[model samples]
Target: MASNETPRQWLKRTAGRGARWTRLSVIAGTLSTLVLLVQAWCIATIAQRMVIDGADFSSLTLPLMLLPPAFIVRGLLIRGRTICSARGGIEIRQSVRRELLERIAVLGPFWARRQHSATLSNRVWDQVDALQGFYADYRPQMLLCGIIPLIILVAVAPLSWAAALILIATGPLIPMNMAMVGIGAKKRQEDQFQEMGRMSRHFLDTLQGLSTLKLFGISKHQAQEVHTASESFRRRTMRVLRLAFLSSTVLEFFASVSIALLALYLGFVYLGQFHFGMYDHGINLFIGLFILILAPEFYQPLRDLGVHYHAKAEAEAAAEDLMPILNRRVFERDTDQPAWQPEASIALTLEGLSARYAGRASPALDNVTFELHANEMLAVIGPSGAGKSTLLNVLMGFMHPEAGGVSIKEGTRPPRALTDIRPDDWQRQIAWVGQSTVIVSGTLADNLRLANDAASDDALLDALEQAALKHWFDALPDGLDTRLGEGGRAVSGGQARRIALARAFLREARLVLLDEPTASLDQASERLVMDALARLSSGRTVVLLTHRMELLALADRVLMMDQGRVRALDTLDALRAPQGPLARPAATDIPERRDV
Candidate 1:
């Protein structure tokens, strides 16, 4: 993953993680080649004694008896290679998946929002899975290509140097031709990977928004998009296969031509038209037959390598997408570093903080400064693109400030910079609930456990009751144990949001960050969530981002932001003045601070 490092190089570096099993596969393959030489020698001796020497059947007993066991041992060795290779593939995949998940965790939810969930899932599963065949078959085969062919050449050189020379000459053709074909194959494979991710993301989006599409009469348009993507992927796949077939053809031609040329030379030597291949004398039936048999073995490794060359291409293409994520430099935070401690309630301060997206023209949070006293509620109101979410992201520890900083203090402790704290320690004290809640494929209890893994059944029930979901829970056929979420039973959007609120309750975090928690809920759902939120927020610090001006009344102060800059910060009563930015909100939506 160094600058200018190729994908193939990255794959080799990754291979080191499971080198033990790969080494076992290599050992078995090498031993199998040696056993193959023994078997070939036995075949040649038997043919020579029977055909040329006119020996009786009884004299051939030993060679014939040794043949079956050698075949069995060779089969066992091949099986051992397969077993070792599979284990190596599993280890490599496990290592890669763990790294990917860890990277996502470190990047945090704010960064993850910028990427497509389906695309990330493809990287986690499909892209990583594509490497299995390479580690399991192509890697060991590539290594044996180097060692096995050399062994075959050595065995043949003593009997027929001309055949060995043919092997030496023709061996490069298969790999050289394969390399040429692989150049184009790799480009196709990379394109395919990209198309696959795009298609997956597209499909997931279409499915998730199917109701919206139907409402707008645009479902047909999305269907056509899917068709277009599917056709493109199919054509790309066919092109890769065509290259694969061409590579195989090239390998077969070179190997066949080399073996045929050796056969002709052995025929001439037998017919006494040639006299120059043997070490001490003219070629005999045993020597010629052994050399011919060993000639094919010399090219076998190269042919096997040709067949699996596509796997190498596939793995490299997968690595092309994966290496950047793995090699991305992350700030190393010290576990033992001193960090600010907020006790009893929360006190927050931001100073001249600035942050920007990768390709943006301006900072998302530009020199924004703010303060909130212990147990205070701050409502951040902004038009879209106004640093409201960015401020919450920084406070929630999902992102760090690019310039300036944030600090926290409680009681008599001195204010300390957020960067001074371990990220884990900072996150432990904050509970975040975004607009949408993710319900994974699991049981109702399993989904709830994601919040607090050790929460007892009674604790979970209590949390559900606290979220106003006690009736919902009781109605389920199996109660807490009932299967829910996808692949089980779907819950309404309200239930999902409440489940998130329950997590916040279970966490008992001192700071509560809500990013438009009631944005898309129905009137009843919104009321239930607000009631739960008020309970969760009471006596704890709260930073709420919303456009709901009615909800602003619940806050001690309302901060207005525009174009990443704070426009105003004041009490809701003050903002409601005719000269202030706020327009008075209707009381029917939400009435009192405590009732919110």
Candidate 2:
């Protein structure tokens, strides 16, 4: 997936990675084509013996008997080719989709949130599916177009070189027409995909914000907008389909013309207009009929290729969208198992740390330095867009800083750069609860065990109890077996955050990262969340990002930040002093509901 590689090249390269499956299909298709040649020769021989030599039907029994089985064998080979190619497509699609998911995961939560869910879904599912048609239908057909037609030419050459010459001349017309049609096909497919993505993104946005639209009395307007977008997408899709159909029609016309010209040449030889096409310097019924019979078969592969040509165009368009994400620089990891052993007493230091997102003017964390000892609860306070949570992302191992760095030191161990720590082992030590909770579709017990999937149901129930989700769990009809998340049951905001807390408890990690976990909860929900947070942080090191002042009660020290730079880092009482940087103001008081 080089930056300058064309989409078509990318597609072929990706498909080539699974060449074993393509070879299986190509081999079967080649066999089928060879059988087709035999079938044609048998038919021509039978007609010559019966009609030209005045042989009786009884003498033709052997060839007649062979016809049915030849037809059956050819059909079976064709079926096998189709099945092999289809299965190959399935495996390739699965592999690509799995790779896309892994890439998404490694891109980290910040990258994940930047993508709109619907656009991401379309890229992973619909776009990946587009690649299937290329492997399943187009690849084999494309190869057969070259192999089968040449086989036809070689078979017919001995009987009538003139027919073979005609085939060679006329055959290029179909492919030429395909080339002209293809010039527009790729653009149309690209347009269609773009429109589809635009429509899907808008539709999903409207759906997610439907309540807001209605509250603002603009739902109808948005409905109209969605309708407009859908209509535009429909038109683009239709245009793409029309381009595909136009290519097929042109190809069929050329193939039919090629076959007809070959027939006319054979007809001329039969009427004694010419005798030079035959090897014997005299035309016979067998030679004439054989060439005519195989005429259309010569162009058959070309015709099939034309029909499936849209698949290639679609795949190329999909590759254009897929390559960027696939080629993204994912978080690095150790190939071998890392032998990192952090001591029980962990200390972390950030020195002149500067960081920014992929495309941003200002750094998200700018020369910001900090230190934390084991079991210390560091509360980071900042206003909106203050980069408070960005620090948490860094601590959570989601991303790296552009300048400066973080290092960790364990008791009796040399300091190691945080980036040197293997991501797997580094992540295993930290449990994170973000503002938005992703509860995948699963049973409640399954959702709670996300960090430690092997956790037993009883252990999950206990963790839920510790997180104060026990009452919510008890209210469910199926208890631990109750379905949650998408398409099952939805949890309230507080419940979702508490569910994350339960996961943290089950994780048994030494370090915890909480990103405004109780940002928008009501009094009771906030209290429950705070109580659970308190219990979860009892022994674990916690980095808490908060905007609420009341939540600062749990912080052993407060780190105030503004515009990606640290403003102050001191005890609350010290920061509240009149001469201190964060001198007390009524505005500094966090909204109520800090205590459990």
Sliding window of 10 residues with minimal summed lDDT for model 1:
587-596
Task: Assess the local accuracy of residue 209 in candidate 2 as a C-alpha lDDT between 0 and 100.
Answer: 94
lDDT of each: 0.85, 0.84
Q: What lDDT tens digits, residue by residue, belong to model 1 across residues 461-532?
A: 888988999988878988877887666888998999999998888877788888888877889998899889
**Model 2: per-residue Cα lDDT over 1-596, one tens digit each:** 47788887777777866678788888988888788767776898898898779888888887788888889998998889888899889988998999899989888767887888888999999999999999899887887787888888888787777788889989888878778877888889988888888999999999999999999999999999999999998888888888888788888888888888877887877787876666865667877777777788888888888888889889999989998988887667566756776767577899999889877898888999889877888898866667876787788788788889889877778888888878878888889887789998999888987889899888898899999988888789888888997788889999999999999999988888887888888999999999998999888788888867677888888988878899899988898888886675764854322211
Model 2 TM: 0.95
Clashes by residue pair, model 1: none
Best by lDDT: 1
Task: List ranges where model 2 is wrong by over 4 Å.
Answer: 331-337, 586-596
Task: Please estimate how well model 1 matches the true structure, expressed as its whole-model Cα lDDT.
Answer: 0.85
